[model samples]
Target: MELIFLGTGAGIPSPERNVTAVALALNEERGTFWLFDCGEATQHQIMRSPLKLSRLEYIFITHLHGDHIYGLPGLLSSRSYHGGTTPLTIFGPAGLARFIETSLQVSGSHLDYELRIEELQEGVIFEDEQFTISCARLEHRIDSYGYRIVEHDLPGRLDRDRLIADGILPGPIYQQIKLSKEPIAYEGRLLDPKRYVGPDIPGRKLAILGDTRPAPNALQLAQTVDVLVHEATFAEAEAELARRYYHTTTRQAAEIAAQAGAGELILTHFSSRYNREDLAWLIQEASRYHKPVYAAYDGYQHPIPRK
Candidate 1:
């Protein structure tokens, strides 16, 4: 899996950074991509990147803030014109449906594919064979949320030596033994699948938070995650202003990542006042507390490390 940052600025678009939009590309895992936020001009950002709209299968809105969701209607409408006929699902807070519906209806936009909008609360929102998504409330100006995307543990590789020693050759029966849950009778002996299987490979976990102050749920959502994407809307000097605006500072975001024991931290949702040149200070401040901290910019692509 890979993370592609479309826009990383907060509140408004700047020349260096646009707004808040992230794409978790799962092309190798599931042949689809999941978007975290769709800020204004998000589609335009996608055009400038290697991301494909047709591969977008899900959109998770962190809140109803205009900067976090203004481009939803346009992206959804344009998906039809592209090669996006497959079903798409969106998860967000309450009133998200009204916003999308009103925007589409007012502009006479129609989609040719199935669209599902699920209002999120503080709980497990989605789960499938591959992934599980959960949300927790955050302390923001509005009802913002942080999402935890946990990938399911994949089955371990088959032990060919064990199979060969047990008189099992590399044939159709090997595939059956690997997939079957019950014991298989091979040469008058019951071969247990568990005995020949190796350990399960742990999956990667990612936590993406919206605009918020440091809260208990933030740590809960990001506990020991592979990547923690948190908002750092202000520098260390602007702690008072950040708290007053119900946002997080660089130090506060770094503390969250350090406390949660996240593998890596990517600080995003920067204030427009700070330009690209100011990112080194933010990254340095965060790195003091957390190793491998990154201040995200538009079109930044990060490859998730496989442990």
Candidate 2:
């Protein structure tokens, strides 16, 4: 899995960075990508990147803030225009459904596929065979949330050498032996997967937080995650201003990542006041609290490695 930052600015667009938008590409695992916080001109950003609107399967809105959701309607409309026939699901806080419905109605825009809007609650909102997603409320000006995505543990690889030693040459039956829940009878003997398969591979965990001050739920959502994506809207010197505006500072975000034991820390949603030269300072500030800290910019991509 990989994370692509479409925009990384805070409240408004700047010359160096745009508003908040992130794409989680799961091409290897699911053959589709999920979007988080589609800010203004998000579609334009996607057009510039390798992401495809037709392959966008899900959207998770952090809050109803204009900077977080202004590009949602335009992107949705353009998906239809581009002939996106696959169903799409959007998860967000309350009032999101109303906003999207009204936007489509007012613009007389129609979708070419099924669109499902789910108003999020502070708990597990989605669970399939491969993943389980949960959300927790965050401390922001308006109701906001942080999401935790946990991929299911993968089955272990087959013990090819052991199978070969047992006269089972490489063939389609090797797959059957590995995938069978019960023992399979072969050559008057039972072939148990437990005896042939290696230990199960651990899955990866990821946390993506919305705009907020340092909140306990943020720690809960990010606990021991492989990657923790959090907003560092201000520098460490602006701690007071950050607290007043319910935004996190670089040091604060890194501290949270350290406390949560995240493998890596990715900081985004930078204030417009900071230019390209200031980003190095922000990274240095965050690195004091957590090692492997990264300051995200427009079009930045971070690939999450398997445990």
Candidate 3:
């Protein structure tokens, strides 16, 4: 999996940055891409990146803020024209459905595919064979939430040497051993499936937070995450302003990362005032407490390696 930042600026699009939009590309794992937020002109930003809109399967919005959902109508309408017949699902807080419906109706946009929406609350947001998504509300101006994506424990890999030593050549049987429950019988004895398994491999985890101040729930949700994507709308010196606006600063974000013991901290949703050079200062301030703090910019893709 990899995270591609289509737009990392906050509130408005800048010459150097766009609004907030993040894409988690899992094409190799599931041939699908999941989006975190769709800021204004998100589709236009996606056009310049290596990501494919056709592969988008899920859109998770953290809140109903205008900067987050402004691009939904255009993206959905364009999806139909781009041959996106596959079903799509969107999960977010209440009023999300109303916003989409009103926007589509007023803009005369129609999609030729299945569109599903889920108004969510604090709990398990999503789950599958490989991952489980956890969410909790954050302290923001309005109702908002933070999301945690915890990957499930993966089964052990097949021991090819053990199979070959047992006179089992490479064929459909090996494929079955790697993927399913259909076991093969060898020399009148049924070989157990577990014998051909190697060591178990653990999966990685990621956390995505919306516009909010530092809260205990946010810290708990991001605990030990492989990658923690938090918002740094201001620097350390702007703590008063940040709290007054119900947002977080660089230092507060770093403290959250340190408190949660996250392996890596990625700070996005920057204020429009700071330039790319100022972004480095934000990272440095964050790194004082947490190592490897990444400041995101438009079109910057950070690969999440399978460990």
Candidate 4:
């Protein structure tokens, strides 16, 4: 899985960055990508990146803030001109359905694909065989939410080399050995599948949070996750301003990641006030509290490897 940052600036767009939009590319795992918070000009950003609008399967909106959702109607409309025929589902806080419906209605825009809008509640919103997505309320000015995505554990690989060494040549029996829960008769002998399989591979966990101040739920959502994507809207020197604005500072984001035991922390949603040159200082402040912390810029890509 990989995270592609289409836009990373906070509130408004700047020459160096756009607004907040992130694409979670799962082409290898699921054959499609999920979007988090489509901000203003997000489609424009996607056009510049390697992502395709036709492959967008899910969209999770953190809040109804204009910077977080202004591009939704336009992107949805444009997807029709592309090859987006598959059904699309959008999960977000209350009032999202009205916004999208009103925008499409007023603009006389129509989509060729099925569009499903689900107003989010603070719990597990989606669950299938492969993954489970849960949300928790965040401490933002609006009813913002943070999402926790947990990929289901995968079955262990068959020890093909060991089987070959044991003179069990590759055949239909190998498939039978891997699928059998109990011992299967293999060449007049019972063989246990567990003995030929490796340990179960652990699933990857990711927590992508919306703009907010430090909250307990944030730590719970991000606990022991492979990656924690949080917002650092201000520098540590502007801690008071951050609190007043219901946003987090660089140091505060790192502290949360460290406290949550996250493997890595990626900070985004930077204020336009800080230009490209000031990012190094922000990373320095965050690194004092946590190792392997990154401040994401527009078009930045971070890969999450399987454990």
Candidate 5:
């Protein structure tokens, strides 16, 4: 899977960064992409990348803040125009449904595809055979959520060479032996699937958090994640200001990653005041506690590997 950061600024757009939006491309895993947030002009950013809006299957809004969700109506309408006929589901706080529906209604917009908006709570929001998504409350100015996306363990490759060596030819019998629950007869010999199948391969985990201060839920959701995307809206010198504004400082975000034992950390949602050159100190401060910490930029792609 790959993570594409569409916008990485906080509150407002800047020359270096836009706002909060991330695309988790699951084309290989599920043949689709899942968006984390849709800030203003997010569709414009997607246009500049290799991502396709038609592959979007889910949109998980962190909160109802303007910086986090202003592009929902426009993106939704544009998706229909772009020939996206599959049903799309959105998960967010209680007010998200009203905001999107009201915006679409006021603009007299009509979509050709079905749109499903769900008000989220602190629990598992979605699950399929491939992945499971769960949410937890975060400490922010308004009600916010952090999402944990866990991929299911995949079965290992079948030993075709071993089966062939054991007087078994490649045919429908191989399919039956692999899928059957009980012992299968192959040329008057019973074969067990356990002997031919390799061990189960572990999947990857990712944690994406919304605008928030330091909280235990953040660490819990990010535990042992392959990548932890957290908001670091202020530098260490602005700790007081960050606390007053209900945002996290560079040091606090790093602390969360270190405590959670995350494999890697990508910091985003930077304040507009800090330019690209000014972001080095933030990364330095965060890296003091955790190694391999990175500051995200718009259009940056981070590919995650299975653990």
Candidate 6:
């Protein structure tokens, strides 16, 4: 899994950044992409990247804020125009379902594929064979939410060497070993997969959230995540103003990352007040408490995800 920051600025688009939208590219894992926050002109950002909008399996909106969801109607409409047949599911705070339907209706937009929208509460919202998603309320001016995505554990790899030593060749039996419920008789002996298989690999977890102030609930959603994409709208120097605006400072986000034990941190939704040269300092400020703190810009891609 990787995080591709499409629009990382806060509130408005700038030459240095777009708005708040992130692409969780799990193409290698599930042959698809997941997005967080479809900010204004977010579809424009995707056009500049290798992302295929038709492959978007899910979209999670942080809140009803314009910068967080204004691009939904356009993106969804574009998906249909591009001949996308895959059904898309959108999860967001209360009223998101109405927002999309209303916007499409007002514009007379028609879609070819299924467009599903769900306004979420503070609990589990989505799950499938690959991942389970949950949300918790965040401390924002509006009813914002933090999302947690947990990937399901995969089966252990079969031990080809053990099977080869027992006069058995690798073939469909290896497949059976990976999916076996009990020991199977291979050749003349009963082969116990538990004895020869490698340890089961646990699925990686990712947490992504939008604009919000420092909250313990955010930490709960982000606990032990491989990646924590958070809204760091201000520098540490503007903590008071950040609180007033219901946003987080770089230091506050770092504290949240540390408390949650996140392996890596990607800070987005930066205020336009800071320049490109100042982003290094902003990241350094967050790196004080957490290593590998990244100050995201539009088109920036992070390939590593912690488990």
Stretches of candidate 6 exceeding 4 Å from the true structure: 185-189, 305-307
Error of 2 at 233 (Å): 0.5
lDDT of 5 by residue, 97-128 (tens): 89999999999999989999999989899999
| Candidate 1 vs 3: which has more TM-score | 1
Instruction: Please give each candidate's TM-score.
Output: 0.96, 0.96, 0.94, 0.96, 0.96, 0.96
> Of the pair 3 and 4, which is ahead by lDDT?
4
Cα deviation at 272, candidate 6, in Å, is 0.8
| Residue pairs in clash, model 5 | none
lDDT of 3 by residue, 1-307 (tens): 9999988887888899888899999877899899999999999988898877888899999988888888899999998987899999999999999999888899888888999999898899789898899789999988888999987766679988888998888888776676654466766878677788755578889999999999999899889999999999999999999999989999899899999989889999999999998877889999998988999988888988867
User: lDDT score, residue 61, model 5?
Assistant: 95
Q: How well is each residue in 204-263 modelled by candidate 6, as lDDT tens digits?
A: 988898689998889999899888988899999999999999999999999999988998
Model 3 per-residue lDDT at 77: 92
Better of 4 and 5 by lDDT: 4
For model 4, the superposed segments whose C-alpha errors exceed 4 Å read: 165-167, 179-189
Local distance difference test scores for all models: 0.92, 0.94, 0.89, 0.95, 0.92, 0.88
Model 3 per-residue lDDT at 187: 65
What is the per-residue lDDT of model 2 for residues 21-128, given as tens digits with 9 covering 90 to 100? Answer: 999999999999999999999999999988989999999999999999999989999998877899999999999999999999999998999999999989999999
Q: What is the lDDT ranking, best to worst?
A: 4, 2, 5, 1, 3, 6
**Clash count for each candidate, listed in order shown:** 0, 0, 0, 0, 0, 0
lDDT of 4 by residue, 129-241 (tens): 88999999999999999999999987789999999998799999888887677898878888888989877789999999998999999999999999999999999999999
lDDT of 1 by residue, 1-307 (tens): 9999999999989778898999999978999899999999999998898888888999999999999999999999989887899999999999999999888899999899999999987899999999999999999999999999999887667899988997788888787777777898887889888877776779999999999999999999999999999999999889999999999999999999999999889999999889989999889988888888998899899998656
User: In lDDT terms, how accurate is model 5?
Assistant: 0.92
Which pairs in model 1 have colliding backbones? none
Worst 10 residues of 6 by lDDT: 298-307
Distance from true location, Cα of 83 in model 6, Å:
1.9
